[model samples]
Target chain A: MKKDKIINRRDFIQTGIRTGIGAGLGIIGFGLISRSVEGKTIWQLDPAKCVQCGNCATECVLQASAVKCIHVTDMCGYCDLCSGFFRPGALELTTGAENKLCPTGAIVRTYVEEPYFEYRIIEELCNGCGKCVQNCGAFGNGSLQLQVRQDLCVNCNQCAIARSCPAEAYSRVEPETAYLLKGFEELKITD
Target chain B: MQQSIKHIKERYIHLTTIIIGCCIFLFWLFYNPVHNFTEAVPGLDNRPPRSSSLGSEVIIGEHFTFFGNAPDPSLTGRWPNFRGADFDNIAKDNVELIDSWPATGPEIMWEKDLGEGHAGVAIYEGRVYVLDYDERKERDILRCFSLVDGTELWRRGYSVPVKRNHGMSRTIPAVDGEFVLTMGPRCHVMCCDATSGEFLWGMDLVKDQKAEEPLWYTGQCPIIDNGVAVLAIGGNALLMGIDCTTGEIVWQTPNPDSLRMSHSSVVPMTIAGKKMYVYNALGGLCGVSAEESDKGKILWTIKDFTPNVIVPSPVYVGDNRIFVTAGYGAGSALVQINKSGGSFSARTLQIYKPSEGMASEQQTPLFKDGHVFNIQTKDAGTTRNQFVCCNPDDFRNILWTSSTTERFGLGPYIIADDKFYIMNDEGELTIARFSTSTFEVLDKAQVIEGDDSWAPMAIADGRLIFRDSKKMVCVDMRANE
Candidate 1:
């Protein structure tokens, strides 16, 4: 009877420890689900505050930065001699890479009409260099801007780009509505 | 028999799990979150589609951006045009100013960052108007600000791609009660409602008049005379007068000699009871009729006084003398216009090198009380870059100079409240007691910490407006009451 009692106690202790660990895991999983449902914040940068310092390209932890250039077609001037696309003092407004301001040639210029050209950004080729953004703001309508593409973003706990942003343009945003776009302030879409 | 049945059931379950995994993989492959979220509604309904038949390459006064309205300070002051209302850089209003600045320096009323240019300002009532080039927007912006505080009231911009030729936008706005006139770097003239900042009319001198833009952009500031916008257009017409209200070319002096536009501006002078407009054209010196009877008629021309780069406008001294000086070692020339038989003829009296006599590099000398004040050119030998006083009687008589220690480099100076406000290239301001016999700097202070502070200064209502290449500042020169 004494030996049987000792064996039962040992078995009870093992079972209790196993139950406790399982309950703890269950509580953690529930918390994670609730947090996600409540809309966990992801990193974002305000385009208005961004100074186009080229840090979004180099400071990101990923080999290909989540930050990319976004074209706000609504705000574009549709200029033939787009300062953002062509180099300053460009002899001709052509699609030549030598005359292009973009180092990666990510901006595709489409001749929409006479004296009006459309500027589109290729997300994959964009390294978030901000050279185009700087020139566009300097000489054209500020349509070319940098934004963090949430699809490519790994959503790190501490974004490396956010930490190094000189203009303090970076902040955490909701995952569902991820973009911080320009030319939308009048619509009051941004908080 | 029981072991065989259990093993078969387990195999069936494994096959079901594999099928479910494959279905999930297929669903993930087709779904694209980026595509779903960023719904770029690029249809014509969402945005206005840009059409090819919109306009030309350069549009004048195409965009008007309103910042914020400022409270009217109701200040009574006026520095209306390039050289003020009198066509002389002298503020002779009743407002009293301090004789000397405090050790802490003049109280800076306000300051604003402009584009990379040396454009000056025009103060009318309580508003300050400046013609600035926005390099980012690639537009010429005529900005109106509150003189009390540095609040930008409104801005009118037009896109005209101007390369930075020694910086752009080198003209001052001519603001009156009714209209504000601005000439862009490319010789595009815009006239706006002075109070409302409404675009009244625009004329592209290059396109409409075929006026060739000056080498370093249009340095000629526009002037308004009795509601007539006087412009020294030098392509098809040597000089043109536009009706400010109707936007009509009232009179235009035909450019028969094909004189190209120069950096010099037209100065209206009345000599021998005859009113005329004296201009230092790139090719020569000419006087157009400013009278109502024979307006736009070229009366006198001295082809001998032509310089490759003429900057200073013709300074008309008494005794029918007009002093013309130019940089690039062009020296100075004294031209006299004589009226004979209701006809005008110009004669070049004397021409001397900078080292031989009084010559100005940038600004037209201030003639006051029978003495002419000028900052001599760097090529003036002992008087190089020095502020000197000379007699208009002789081109070589330099009575007084600011000395070797005080030199103003291509900067500008103005006379206000019996004091001379001189600025150096580095923006050091010197306030000297206005005296032709002696040079005395009452106080000196650094107003702007930048290079190329060569824009002409404007003062009214005890407020002095000065600028560097990149910034403009206003200081309260009113005496502490």
Candidate 2:
């Protein structure tokens, strides 16, 4: 009987040790999850501070930079002679390849009305050169800007483009505020 | 070795003979002796035509962009027209204002960024209207904003290329309860629903009426009187009254003398027991009959007081006299009109140079209580840029002039709460007690941060709206109590 009791005691002691270790691990795991939820962040660029330095195109780790041009249509003036679409002092404003401002011909110009023209960007061809963005801000309403496309971004531990940006417009932002857009405060979305 | 050398020479000769024959054959096959040059036919090349025929063929009020609308506020104050409802630069409302400012100026309610221009504001009910020129789009936009918070409600615009001339927009919008009328920098008149921003009608005066575009664009503000919009058109007609509801020309005064449009607006004046629209045209000063039966008929005209460039409208004083002034050393003149037996005649009562009398460069002199008040032009000798008050009965009698340190630029001034709110070129606002005998500055502060704050101000419901070249601000001028 004593022998059986001794065996039972040994088993109880072993189980207790295992339970204590599992409880401690559970507590540690819960704390780590909560901390991550509170401090999760993503890299974002403030367009207002961006100087269009052309580093975003080359410094990105991706083959094609995850950075892409974003069009805030609400702020766009819909101008016929869009400074963003045509090269400075362009002989003729047309869809001809010579007059295009984009090196890769990513911007598409469409007629909206008698004198208004709408501009849109194709993401696949964009190289984040920011040439159009620079000219647009200088001469027209600054509706074109650069942003990191979350789906294309690899979310590296240290963003390559952010390190090389001269303007230091890059900062860590939460996922909800992944984009720093202009004219968003002044304009409210309507039907 | 000798035999081999002979063989090599023979082979070389054979190769050379074959090469010469091939060259001759190639020249015969490819050479063309006839030179052919023909004129190239147009469109033979497959290149597309350029689409850059812009800055032409702009239909006024063709497009509208709407932002989200805020809940309409229930404030009921109105500064309906260019001046006030009474056609005076005075706030007649009973909104009590503080006697002095708080050194930091009045409490600014809101600030908004406007297109670069000096276009003034018009307030009606709880909405504010201004005609702004969008430089990037080359459009004239009539913007409406909430009076309480300065939120842009909506905008109606049309693409018209207006090159920058001392900042583009140069006029104020006139708003009634139902409709708002705006004259663009290029003389495009647009009318829209005041509340809904729906376009009602538009007219290009330069195209339709052949109205000459004045230098530095149109500075004439439209006025709506008794359901009719009155505009002093200068090429084809002297004055035109359009029915506001139907967009039809109700009456037009013929321009017999080829008077050109000026940078001045039409002022409705009652003189010598006659209600008329007084206009200071580039060629002459004339009065048009405003009575319904004889509407748009020329009542009287005098060419003696006409300046090469007139900026200030004729101010009507009592006893059938009108005070006229201009900048650039044109000086000041007073004209007396005598009406007898349904006929009118005018003669200059007194005319003096800017240095000898009270003169204005930009704004019209305010005639109140038998005294005229104006900021003298830069050529007024000792009183240059000084705010001077003079007795209209005697042009030689100067009542008071502001100190030399208290000079003003070409900005605008208005009377509210028995005080004068005047702004300078750099947006420094000064409030002075409105006294004929003396000038007492109650307070002063820098309200805006830019240059050329020359646009006129509008006040209503204790809210004063003013603008610099690119920023518009709203301030609550009510007393704290």
Candidate 3:
């Protein structure tokens, strides 16, 4: 009976060790899988497909839409009379509240050269209305585009903005390439 | 009293500590002072309202600004004015444009975005001129670019609050060695130095000339001949010749009948060795004297041969013969001007519907070797929108058609070196031959991927510049090399 009991105890101890090893390995595997899946994907705007219909500003559930205008400095023409900044047919080509195309006054234009003015966007103030983007794409070099900042985004599985987007321009992209900018294509004059 | 004082003193220390903590919390809560958001600086994101109408109160020739610096002049050949260096829409000296495009198609040297319009470009030696409208700033800009790389050289503009009327600018700039003349969509004509972007002179036709804007904005392409810019004003004057150097009005054609202007441009035609400016006005057709002796004098005016609307300029077919066409069921007419007894008399030889004969909508027919080549309008029965060649004598004699397989819609074609460089509305450029009996498309290439490749082709030094609605492209079409 003692021999049998000892045999049973040994069996139990082996089973426990096997169970412990299996659980440990399974935990490690799960940790790797979770790490690979978590925070790796982000919201992206495919600008080529984006129609700039002003939905980016209003569709998001957040009080202030996470979408903001991204200015690609290299693509910008830096015109003294920027189409994105000023309303069409402003009386004088000057910076003023009435003349500004941006509803929230997010873009800041600074003098860079004699005729060139560098435009930078303030993300917090930007409402993603896409009015400036519309004007810029229509008239200027299309440097200004709307993008979803992952830091400000809640990372919803089904984004409200994406659901309402008419162009279906939103997609889950790798964190590295979260924005697609026109005129900044690596390929020169492909079209 | 001592016990009470001792107990009160022990409680006093704890009470004092609580009071101090409360005071610190209150101070932290109310320490920061609040002020309103900074008032937007004056003239920074602040401006007055824009006027709704197009004939802008905004000053003309107010701003002559230089944008990007132009490169050193290297290209020597000149397209000069609207039709190439020569008055005829044909390239001279460079015959190499006849060769077929490479397998990969013509290499697009460069392209730039233009405001939505058919407003085309004019190439002088090394510069490209386009009158572009900035819709946002409410300005009509005269932009100059380098011929080599398409880099913007300089821009001269004036504020004009014009709204989009099916693409704002439509006229092409008339450029020469000394000056460049541009007519804005709102009937404002501007003159500037061709090389320096210097503001030379400005005139508002509505304000100064009493000229009525065309129905769909001006489609009239300006022409400069012998340093004199000839414009079919069609107001109080049927034609006006301005010395491009001084911007001075050299001569004017009287409009006794009060005929309105059409979209047709003034084409220099020589019948019986007499040079005259033939223009198809809204009411009828007139041939104005282009000679220095009697510049701008209406040599002959035909009142009966009139179309409801005329877009394309008349083509010089034979001696004393001109072919005039219009779309919208207006059909085609051949006007033969007989300069007998030192005077001119015009009579319509043949007039027929588009389906019955050779009729064109937007492009003027090419008269070469006694044959007329043009893309027949859709109303043309079997060969609708096909590049067809017909005998000028008999408009219905279709010697050869592009066939159903090779049809194009209202495109532009130019003949160079016995070959035709034809561009379809879908941006397909077909290099064909001027065959007497067949349509031979030697090579076809998609030079541009966009639609509406409608801007008339301009070739200078074997370089061809063309555009659609949005993009302007340049390609080297040198035949020899």
Candidate 4:
């Protein structure tokens, strides 16, 4: 019978070479399971579950509030008139960035040797805008605060400046040893 | 009938040549790019032979062997990623230590308490990772201790509250054997699960590559290699890689030439035989090429020795040279490289600044035996942060410094036996003894009663780990036990 039609045309050419190697291995396994699953997960931020609402400075897309303002020189009080660097009247008392009250000049003041001065806080030009922790908690001694500098805080899960914090003053923390030294027992030096 | 019309014309030419040879072998295996380069570089193409059933209780390439002598395997001591391990803070193995330590020295062996940030420590095998910053739970942990009694063991991370400027999660994780990556200062990354801490995978390399992060945010540290990982993450794709078991990007490296991720750490290097990677990009020092499927290519770039705030971590010493340093004063550069024909060039043999002596800003100098060891700072009182020991060919004239008392020293210096422990920043610890001219303190102590300990410190097997913004110690130099 013509050799059974050449063995049915050699089993239809071996089932079309095993369906072309199973459709080229299902399109390289669906392009490697869709590139493994895109960018995995690392978004972090739990500073005790953050609620400090300022929406991380208008919900950061970066206009300067990578959530800044941080100074705990042992909760600072090495004061000389540092309500986080002046601006109630600013009539004179030098160390200028325009009578600094941090609107984005980000306080710097350095001196630390003669009756102390060391202000420091350029947290990328802080826009966490608490007005230098409200003039360093009204007339210095509070040592400016508003944490969340987790290296420029991008832990963002819902923090668009803590959802526009009016004074919800953000929360969510757990960064192992989360910063909290607001005036180191009044700048310790008790002999 | 003529054999039934010649068997229906050979069954219609064997079913149209087996359906056009299965549609041209499924369109040449989906338009082949070398079959998508072994599915985008997964160990390249089947390589699983080196197991030999634990040959003689294995210990293979001897990454610093230590078993009965006790200098190498104490639950697997790890400086895990960045500068520790071959990134080059040097710690390939060998300990036996204790040339001195007894005046209240070397017997602490345990401390725990840690949580502020500067994030460094990634020991592995027996645990002891770190990332800190947990003000009550604002979150940023990743912890995991137990290098032998430091305890803790599992932490993972979240939250993110911070406030202290001189303190805040820095970035340094990348372990290997089964994953334990991490990057997060702001670049995210994550990975997890080396034994059970579990997180599995993560990404956010600066909002999916719009990438900028680094005024103090992403301190680089995330290299991996072979199993993939990479990540310098400076948009237009400065470097990506991924897929250390399915995180999956597997090849990005195309900054076109934008660069940007330099607080330092991504070094790898190989040169003449070709492996490459090297880094330090905001405007200068590159090298890429890790073996072309294209994850990175750069090869070489210099850019006038750029520095505005680079933060040390490039040291390659011997075999084409390379050394870099930075801080507010911005000084130190060596370079060299060369290659020719296939491409690579570099140049710039020495630059010096900070008054021309040693000047690093956060540990990453030590080259060893041929001499390099650094730690200078204090800008202009003629060098006060001390602890030098130069001569890498005309970065010139210092040979030795370190009478101790200089203050703010940035942590990192741990060589055992040839001595040199150092740790100052107000937590003290000294020990010195690296001769070529002088630096022989021999004993100091203070092991973290607290105060800016600056991070860096992780000996292995014979154990010594260190840390401070709160706590994380582990002394036990071995020899008396």
Candidate 5:
């Protein structure tokens, strides 16, 4: 009777371990599947065709649009006179709000060297206006571009910004190609 | 009574003198000319808005910045100077280029939004350079970029507010191994290091040289020669050469005729073993000595072929012929230069109206294989805007013209890989073979949607670049792609 009881105890221990592992795996898989569905087929911008109009600054379901300037570090010129950082009427190169290119002062510039600099966007400050992108494309390498942050976007059935885009730059892209990255090796050429 | 009368007369005389003094004091207060002055600092005016006049100064050496990484320099065809190294708008690349584009059209390698202008571009080693006017910034900027990828390398500029007069910044930057020279729309001359955005020197042609502003801004593109910036100033000096490195006047040609400035750039030509600088000034056309012995002396000049609006530079053909032409009903003329015993003489050989032969409104004609090809001016009756080819021996001979189906306005044309690339003002670019017997177009494509795509075309390393009033594009013309 004692031997039989010991055998049952071992069997119970093995089943408990197996069940625990299976439940852990099941939870991870379910979380991934749900996340994919939540963020599926979000609105994005085609970097190649975007005209950088100021419409992204407005025409959003949110008071502050989910659009923001994304910098491609590999393609950056690192110019001290960064068009995306300094305002057009800036009297001098400084960190003052009056001299900033971003209306909300979202871009933060850090000096890397005598002629080089690094720019980062404080996402919290960005309103997705696209003014900086226009300036950068005009005078820089276009390293700074506009993007729709899916996390902040509501995935509206009818996008308010797309309805007003003159270039028709906004579209619903697959999740794998969610963002039109500037440094992305291949750019999709469109008509 | 006599004493009282004398005392009253003295009092009356004192009162009259006091009244007269008061009147004189009033006159002095009203007419005194105490001057108040706002003396402008020569090259550093704080760029006020709506500044279209000459001597409206700009801050020189205000900004210099470097961007983008350099490209690998191999088989990189160079358009290092204006109109290529030979001063002719011809590509020196041997890379096999597509004679015709694919159905999707010539693939745009990259595109950049530009401020309003017709500024052309120059490519050297593996970089492209252009002088552009930033309307929002109110400054003239010299931007450098990678030729293969359209990535910006650097920009050097200063603030000088300019209004839209037709357009702004129409001249291209002259780039060499060491320096790049740019002539701003308001006559500000700037030179910077070619590789880095180092400001070497800047000069105001209006303040220092007293050059009269052309009806438009300075359309005369600067050219670099032997480390000197060659400029047709037409100020106190008809022409002047500045040491690019030191910013010193090396030589100056006297403007005895007081010929005003024209929009045409100077062309260097060798006639009878003598190299001369030929310029089409406002009052006349002249050939000046480019020799070290008498570098700035006028070799020969002609006033009969003068046109008030001269845009095309004079072209040298064969041993003794210099062809000159202009638009606005000014027509075209062929001038013959005769050298006898070290003395030079010039005379107009043939003069013809637009309808009679060949005339171009904007771009200089291309002279290739004993034939001259030009898009005829709008005044040429039925042949208006037609790409017409004529034998140089007889400009009047009916050679061939593109059919009425494909007409190009004042856009640019360049010969590359044995094909004629012609762009129209409406932004349609056509590719045609160079033929003397017949006019034929192989393909057509719209490059830019904007109007006034009149900037001259530039090509390097099988990359074709052209611009309209609003934007510029770089296209891949490489073969087997």
Candidate 6:
């Protein structure tokens, strides 16, 4: 009777130790599996495909659309009747915020020379609304277009701006080569 | 009976102790859940060493200096500069590369962890040069490595803080025979010893010209021609050519008309037997007379075809035709250049949206045998993006298209041995054998496990160098013995 009791006590101790070990392992396994799921996403953009639709302003989870306007000055006409800067059929051709086609008044116009004027864009104020792009493409040289500024882009899933683009302009670009300019060349220019 | 009672009592005491120990362990495991004491301990994170000093010992080798031996006259396969020998994305002779890669594609010989940058590789004299961001030092680096073993030979760069816009720096280095020229993320031009990696001279175009930096940063790769480093400073000054040997300002393309610099680089062209510099500036596309002392002659300007963004390098196929494309519904255009009386005029032949054909972001279209091949983005009519081929004269009809797997591709196409090598955004290296009818995918492999393998590829002495934002890889595509 005494020997039987001793053997039973030993077995009980062993079982308790085994149960504790199994529980510990279960906790560790759960932690590791959760970590693996978190390592999957790196957001990027494709410049060649981005369509400048107004959804970039509203669809983005952030307060501002990551998509902004970029200007290729080489492609600019430097015209006095600037389509990218002023609203179509504006009452007057002046540098008034209300007369600008861009809803946020992002484009700044400056006198470059006698017949030419330099137009620059303040990208942060741009909402990718395509107002300036529409005006630029229609009237003056098409120098302004909506580009998903990768730096500002959160790289969201189903990029809200891309889905809403009317021209279907948003395409996935290699983030490395994402920025597209209007008239940049690859060769050395000799003066 | 007394002895038995004593033994039972001892057994009960031992059992009680065992149960108490178990309770203590469970309490330790569950108590103070907020602390995570075990994980907070040292030697547990399993991260790579974070010491900033680790990069200092990563010795760039001894081959950075250039002694200028008239580069071998008969050297057939040297990709001497940014795009290639002529700033065109065309390889010299027909090389017979392997038509197909395995399911995962060609074997990756080696890969090294690199800092961020969009700068591509420059291969010359069996060596490879690249510009990359070094986060540890907070500076951009110009690193040269041996093409054979992927070993660093030398690196030269000063500290520049990275601005928070998707990281900084994107210009590729231009490698000529005796010099390597680089444009920093902020439009600073640095001419370095091609072999030694020593800083020769630096010029800040941003401050000198009072020009605003581009949206992302300066991306125009410095151009080296006839011992001069030519750069496009987008201010009132249109273009500037600096003497590579002495770092002196050789000539500045006068901005008498006040044209700003576009993101495009300068392209050298020979039209009607007259050499001219084809530059796309902010105001318009202008062709400056290469032989003129003034260098500011505007040959022709295409104001109507200007798109919002022009990122792709212009590809000049014949003496008379030029192709330009961009994203954002801004389509592709083919221009016909007519030269007479020592001046030229360009007329647009066709303009089609991305739905009709290929649109390029950063890579110049590959022109060969009267056919143009490029990776096109999507548009209104088409739901899919692809690699396409078409006639250069008419951008209208598509000759063929790649597989439609919803995968997007960017950057330049590389040709080797009658085959085209394309790296997609997801890091798949696809080798296609070119025929007029179709792009036959011989093989495809995921060479790197990262995003944005968009830098233009460099191949020299039978090695192919490619990169993503985080790493650069050198693959041996040569035939195995």
Best by DockQ: 3
> Which digits, one per residue and each the tens of the lDDT, describe model 1 over residues A82-162?
768877545344666666788877887776543356778888789999999877875455788899988889889999999
Preferred candidate (DockQ higher): 1 or 3: 3
Relative to the unseen true structure, what is the C-alpha lDDT of residue A182 in candidate 2, on a scale of 0 to 100? 95
lDDT of 1 by residue, B300-326 (tens): 888876666678888887899999998
lDDT of 3 by residue, B288-367 (tens): 88888888788888866566557788888886788899865467888888878889899988888788989987887787
- Cα-based lDDT at residue A21, candidate 3: 100
| Tens-digit lDDT track of model 2 for B1-481 | 9999999999999999999999999999888765443222232223354332334886878889888566356788889878777777889888888777776656899999888888889998888889998899889999889998888899999999877655789898888888889898878898888888888888888778989777567889999988788998997899999877778999999999888898888999888888899898988989999988799999999887666567777888779899888875578888898999897778888888788988887787787777888888765778878888998876756678998899996888988989899888799889899898999998888899998898988999999999999999998889854
Can you tell me which runs of candidate 3 are displaced by over 4 Å?
A: A1-191, B1-55, B68-72, B479-481
Q: What is the fnat value (0 to 1) for candidate 4? A: 0.00
Model 4: per-residue Cα lDDT over B1-481, one tens digit each: 9999999999989999999999999988788565432122112113342221211221111111111111224375566776666766666667567777776656877787766666667787667677666777555666666677776656667554344445567777878757878776656677766666667667666556767666545677787877788877767687778887788886777777786787787788787767888888767788788886544777778876776457677887776888887755566788888888988889988876766766686678887887887777644135557777877876657766775554446776766667777788777888777676777787777777777677777777777777777777788887656
Quote the positional error of residue B415 for candidate 3 in Å: 1.4
**What global local distance difference test value does model 6 have?**
0.67
lDDT of each: 0.84, 0.83, 0.79, 0.67, 0.82, 0.67
* Candidate 6 segments exceeding 4 Å error: A1-191, B1-76, B93-95, B102-105, B292-297, B356-358
3 versus 6: better TM-score goes to: 3
Worst 10 residues of 4 chain B by lDDT: B59-68
Clashing pairs in 5: none
lDDT of 5: 0.82
Between prediction 1 and prediction 4, the one with superior lDDT is 1
Across residues B1-481, which tens digit of lDDT does each residue of candidate 5 receive? 9999999999999999998998899888787474542222221212223333435457776877777657657836788766778777878678778878788877999988888988889888888888898999889999998887888999999998677755787998888878999998878899999888689999888778888777557788899989999999888899999999999999999999998788899999998789999999988889889999999899998988776667877877665788788875577888889899997989888888777888876898887777788888866767888999987777776488897877897889988888899999889999998777787888888878997898888888888889999888999988866
Q: For candidate 1, give the lDDT of residue B80.
A: 94
The sequence of per-residue lDDT tens digits that candidate 3 reaches over residues A29-84 is 99998897677787778877877888878888887999999998777766656778
Superior by lDDT: candidate 4 or candidate 6: 6
State the DockQ, from 0 to 1, for candidate 4: 0.01
TM-score of chain B only, all predictions?
Answer: 0.87, 0.87, 0.85, 0.33, 0.87, 0.80
